[model samples]
Target: MDVRELRNCFGRFATGVTVVTWKTDDHEYNGITVNSFTSVSLDPALVLVSIDKKAKACQALENRPFVVNILASNQEPIAWQFAGRPQEKLTLEWEETEVGPKIAGAIATIECIPWNAYEGGDHILFVGEIKAFSYNDKDALMFFKGKFINN
Candidate 1:
């Protein structure tokens, strides 16, 4: 099947949008908008996030801690900003965590330390050992069929 067709088929399964934030060795903050966040294990409190091999976050995450910020429904602009589409007049607030920096107002936040890295086709699968997490009861931003949806 063509890649586009395969991607469209995959898109049939909707996913929540997340921003994977990490601190550079130089103390800089970087992130990427992702939809491939998943809870891998409950017993060990592990989560997984897949990032394209070429994304800067993929490189920055090496041996560094990161936060998976589950976007709230109203935070679409933040999502777009991290996804490489800058939104005019976008402003942000951040909170420093033991693991990394977190974008405020997310529906949930998962702070984790890098546990493992694996090679995946065109992407890097990062397994995180969850160190801390927090959540609020809020609607989530979602992605489906190439567009953003708030639910």
Candidate 2:
């Protein structure tokens, strides 16, 4: 099967949008939009975010603390901005956390410490041990069939 066809097939599954943020060794803030995030374990409070091998943030995430900002329905611009489509000097609102910067209006924010990394074909699966997390009662930003949806 063609790659695009396989991708489209995968897209049929609706998933929440998230931005994974981390700090560099120089204290620079970096983030990337991802949908390949999920809970891995409850006993150990673990979660996972899959980053494309070629993405710059993939390298930054190695052995670092990071936050997963689960986008709210109104945060599509934040999603696009971090996804590498900067819209002319967009300013992001952030709240400082012990782990990293959390998007101010995200429906949920999960802070984690790097636990393990694994080979995932063209992507790298980064598992994190959850350190802290919080959530709000807001609609989530979702992706399905290659488009963002608020529900």
Candidate 3:
């Protein structure tokens, strides 16, 4: 299928907005936008995030731990900022946790260590072992079709 058709098909499923972030050599690299995140297991606290094989962040995730910033409804701008405007000069505040760094104003933040990885068509599935979690009581930022919406 073509890109638009594929996107339209995938858009049927609404998903929460997430910014999957990782650090390397004292510098932070982030994906800004991701919806391919889900809980996998409760026994081992495993979560999976599917990253495009060609995405810059995929390279870092191959061998490094990262942070999953689950955006709060109020943080929609943060989602857009990370999604396509990384250099837009927006102020981002975050705190450090046992596993990694997390966005300060996010609805929920998960710190994960890369536990497993596998190729899936055009994406790489990064299974992460949850080390810690935190949350702020608020609505979530969601995405549908080609726009950002509230959930």
- Writing each residue's lDDT as its tens digit, candidate 3 over 1-151 gives 5989988999988899998877766665455478899999998999999988888778877878888888987777788777676546678887766666678888888888989999999999999998888887899988888788876
Error of 1 at 147 (Å): 0.8
Q: Per model, state how many residue pairs clash.
A: 0, 0, 1
lDDT of each: 0.93, 0.93, 0.82
Tell me the TM-score of each prediction against the true structure.
Answer: 0.97, 0.97, 0.90
On residues 32-81, what C-alpha lDDT tens digit does candidate 1 reach at each position?
99999899999899999999999877888887899999999999999999
C-alpha RMSD of each candidate structure in angstroms: 0.8, 1.0, 1.8
Clashing pairs in 2: none
Model 3: weakest 10-residue lDDT segment is 23-32
lDDT tens digits, residue span 1-151, model 2: 7999999999999999999998778887889999999999999999999999999888888899999999999889899999999967667888999999899999999999989999999999999999999999999999999999976
**Which candidate would rank higher by lDDT, 1 or 3?**
1
Candidate structures ordered by lDDT, highest first = 2, 1, 3
